[model samples]
Target: METNSMEAIVLEAPGPPEALQLRELPIPVPAPGQVLIRVKAFGLNRSELHTRLGLAEGVTFPRVPGIEATGVVAAAPAGEFAPGQQVMAMMGGMGRTFDGGYAQYTCVPAGQVIPFRSDLDWAVLGAVPETLQTAYGSLTEALDVRPGQTLLIRGGTSSVGMTAAVLAKRLGITVLATTRNEAKAAALKGIGVDHVLIDDGAVAERVREIFPDGVDNALELVGVPTLPDTLRAVRKHGVVCFSGMLSNEWIVKDFYPIGYLPRGVRLAAYGGDANDLPQAVLQEFLDAVAAGEAVVPLDRTYRLDQIAQAHADMEANRAAGKLVVLP
Candidate 1:
């Protein structure tokens, strides 16, 4: 690959994972207030998979598909970022609007980039920015999780769910996580979760056994299908944060009004708007990673050429943690 031309995974059409193909394209230049990164690794999210399959609209074709990435700064606006500095960035309209981290290099706005601590590995750092921020935002800002409270995290073993579980534990909040896999129950316990429910229809019953009435907060990662169930598991005056919908159901049947509103519940959705969350929360998430209170698990790594396989693995739910694409 020439310096001015780099290899990237491009989706010329929407369909299966095989739609992704590696091709050489002209390297993009960073604009003012932007930095060019020599991407070391990028993490895959369900949003990327949706975008690749045309499930997520508004994304132009021939797009490079990756949202969260960690890399070395190749170039930056003067006084903004120094060359060779390690950094991470995440958000939409990134891999969505312009080319993203599926390539050898990507140019992101300097404002969106965060410097990583020297001790962090590139793969771990790459995995941190998106899921951690989402979890932190939902827990602290949306749900106002506090010490002595109890939180129920649906999709407990997932990257965001696990991040929420660890952060909540650190804050003195008891964590009860839900998983479809019984094998993951032990892993949840190892990560400081107090309880792990194996997706039984009796989630409310199990929650009552642990928290008596219900949990103080809930993080709904599975979306609509679990929304009603989450409502049933939260205590009066509790809060619920909705962020993901991996269940593939777009239309939520009927709202469980009595279960949510009559109980003085707060239902919140985040990640659509960046400014909806404070930058301080994002910094706190990064600091937690720096201090070793939180860790981003790198389940597998694939080369840029293996993007199709990576997507396939993610869609199959075979990845236990973050999946990284090394360029």
Candidate 2:
């Protein structure tokens, strides 16, 4: 049912945002154990920014930039999915190892094509996969957040941070979300964050003032530069989760002695992937979105021609929320 070719954003070479070019690509067909998705929308991730700058080492040029997509299955294996079923694909080498959903159609591995029946729009679905999965997986697998627990979210203005706040709040956990700009305090509060703290390099001290006993858990979205403060804010036996590196610092130059870590304090990290994103978590998130219990903050939508603008917006930190590209 496809035409000879479809429009797509092709990354011909690694460079600035302008490297993305609109090209007419033949509609992709599914191979054995692969599913062809007629992509309606896809979300942009900071990792995509890294991939574009060739920061993702060993990635060759002429790649696609999207990591997740939502749409109907154009073709899938028998008994796997029928044509036109609502589905989403994420973090299974979609945009990394192969051509991804920067086009009108994309072929994804069948195992990674998750089918979800929902009334959610394409943009919402596109926004859900990476953000919610990462947040939920980190919260559950890494932090194990629970009711009555006081948690701190470092880099709380980012999409994953906001998602963690919502999921944590919904689970009866008290969330202290952070922002470098105090101006976003009100905005953070609007999105179910119980409290908003300004991250002014004194995050540990600020948390201590709020909860002198220290918080039960902390999810560090910012990297190593801020992880020390995040760990310091946690009580003995409390957990600190490192999930993202928005601060661009990947390594801890000063590896302190084992005793330097708080006694009995546990450090955990979650890297989201196809396996990390359990169906139960996706269902819980989707049901929340459907019931209006969770707010999926969609920033804006852009056409394929606006791919550069999308990347620029994300790189400049101008994206206030999740940004989706509609094809």
Query: lDDT of each model, Cα atoms only?
Result: 0.79, 0.84
For candidate 1, what is the lDDT? 0.79
Give per-model TM-scores.
0.91, 0.95
Distance from true location, Cα of 73 in model 1, Å: 1.3
Question: Candidate 2 residues 1-327, lDDT tens each?
Answer: 737788988887778999988888878767779988999889888778878887775566687667888899888765588998988888778777888878888888887877788888888888888898889899999988889999999989888988888888888999998898877777788888887888888889989998997999999988988888888999999999999888766777767848557777889889878667877778778888899888887878998899999989888877556889989
Model 2, clash count? Answer: 0
Summarize candidate 1's per-residue lDDT along 156-199 as a digit string, tens digits.
87778887887888899989999887876777887888988998
Native-to-model Cα distance after best TM-score fit, residue 308 in candidate 2, in Å: 0.7
Which ranges in model 1 have alpha carbons more than 4 Å from their true place? 253-262, 272-292
- The pairs that clash in candidate 2 are none
Model 1: colliding residue pairs: none
RMSD of each candidate relative to the true structure: 2.4, 1.7
